[model samples]
Target: MRVPHIYQASSIALNTPVSLNDDAAGHIGRVLRMKVGEHVSIFNGEGGEYFSEIIEVTKKSVVVMPLRFDEHNVESELNIHLGQCVSRGDKMDFTIQKSVELGINEITPIFSQRCGVKLSGDRLEKKHQQWQKIAISAAEQSGRNYVPVVHPPVDLKQWLEQHTDEIKLTLHPRAEHSIKTITVPSAGVRFLVGPEGGFTDEEMAQTKQQEFVDIRLGPRVLRTETAALTVLSALQLQFGDLAN
Candidate 1:
């Protein structure tokens, strides 16, 4: 059987017993029904993983002793930060999950003029936490030791104004440039995926002003969720780990 990979919020050290947090504990003890002496892999999002064996399991916690450490790195060489305009319902959740699996390093939920979601205050904070959890889960499932970050939601303008040396891109149907035509970036990549209704003309103007090059993916327009995944896969194939 494949050793279960669990993410713990606590620091881990070799030969020391580590108690998993409640969420992970529940997964190993209650959900997986794992017994003592069973092996599990644990990562704290600090890079690499600990090969541990369960020493204790209780209703409330699971304690494991680290036997060895692997400096495994599955992150893409092409660093990508995705600025995705919030889509409604489970669309947003699905995008966040699949984006992490596609090797996106950072994701920021963006509030554009056409974005229909209106979360704020505690509700917004809760959603942000949920999205982060999705990212972590994706990392574990995809065998990625380093978890990607799901940053707090920000306004489109706020995200656009942040200075970045990376290549900036935004989708535009009428644009002359395609992803194939843009010069390969030496550093990272920052791209925007607009909402289901697409970005307003004013928002498009702002992106251009911020030096976001408009690029066309293909002839047919894709849905908001499809667009995000397509961009990630295309970029990965062109410049990231999938290039191999």
Candidate 2:
């Protein structure tokens, strides 16, 4: 069986015992039914993993002794920050999950002109926190040492103004530019994906004025969530850390 890799927020050090919080404890001790002395890998999402073994497993907590520390760097050479337009219901959640698994470095939920989701105040905070959890879970599952950050929702224009990445692009179905034809950026990319209804003409024009390259995924129109992951995969395969 594959040893479980769990995400713990606590700091891990060599030859130290770390106590897991209740949620991780429940999953490891009850769901997985792992007993004391079983080996498991734990990471704090701080660029390394602690190879540990369960020393004590209880209903409330699981204590593990770190046997070794390994610096497993799984980050992509390409730093990608996805400005994903906010969508309704589970679609937005699914987008954040898949994006993290596909190796996005950071994400911002963009509330664009065509985005129909209206979130504010506490409700918006809750949604952002939930998306953050999704990113953490994906990092743990995908064997990533560092967790990608999911920033709170912001207006597309505001995010555009704050875009400081070396390579900036936006997805538009009717764009003349194809990603396959562009040169690979040496530093990082800040890409945008539109919502269900896509971006408005004014938004497109503004992005173009900002010098954001408009790129097309293909002829077939993909869903709002599908476009982000597809572009991430393509970038990773072409210029990032996917050597295989």
Candidate 3:
């Protein structure tokens, strides 16, 4: 059977006994009901994994002894920074989760004019924390050694102004340019995706002034969440790590 993988924040070394965190302990002991001597893989988001065997399981704690270490470097060659307009409800969460799985390097949630979600003060802070946790968990599940950074939401125009040097491109169904038209830069790509209603003319103009080229996926209209994932998948297949 494939051993279950769990993420731990503690440093791991061979022969060292480590106690699983409460959350992980419950998962192993109650959820999976793993028995003593069963193998489990643990990673700390440090680019390596520890192979361990369960030593003890109690109501409050689960301990394991590390037997070996396996170093894995599966990071993408292309660095993709997604400037995504936050979607409503669980769509945003799903986008963040799938983005990590698809190998996006960084994500910056944006508050565009057309964006439906709104947050302020503590609510904004709470949302950021929740999104960050999602990114971390997704990274763990996807076998990514590096955790993608989730930046706080910024207004679209401000974000464009701040990241002037990034190769910015915004998705627009009516745009003349296609993915094939753009030259793949050796450095990386920073893609902007609009919200449900898409970007306004003013927003599009601002992005254009910031030198962000307008591109289209095809003739059909894609939702805000779908647009980001589609671009990410295409980049990974065409110029990034997926093809490799």
Compute each candidate's TM-score over C-alphas.
0.98, 0.95, 0.92
Query: Candidate 1 regions off by >4 Å?
Result: none
| C-alpha lDDT score of every prediction, in listed order | 0.93, 0.88, 0.89
Best by TM-score: 1
| Preferred candidate (lDDT higher): 2 or 3 | 3
Return the candidate ranking by lDDT, descending: 1, 3, 2
Pairs of residues clashing in candidate 3: none
Error of 1 at 12 (Å): 1.2
lDDT of prediction 2 = 0.88
Q: What is candidate 3's lDDT per residue for 1-244, written digit by digit as tens?
A: 8777788877888898999988788889999899899998888877878889999998889999999898877789988999999999999999999999999988999998889999989999999989988997898778777789999989887889974455778899999999878876766899999999888889888988989999999999998889999999998898888676
lDDT of 1: 0.93
lDDT of 2 by residue, 1-244 (tens): 9888888998888888899977678889999999998998898877789889999987778999999988888888888899999999899889888888889999999898889999999999998999998898888888888889898788988988884846889998888999888776666888999989988889999898888999998998999888999999999888888845
lDDT of 3 at 177: 95
Off by over 4 Å in 2: none
For candidate 1, lDDT tens digit of each residue in 15-102?
Answer: 9999998888998999899999999999998989999999999889889999999998888899999999999999999999999999
Residue 196 displacement (Å), model 1: 0.8
Q: Which scores higher on TM-score, 2 or 3?
A: 2
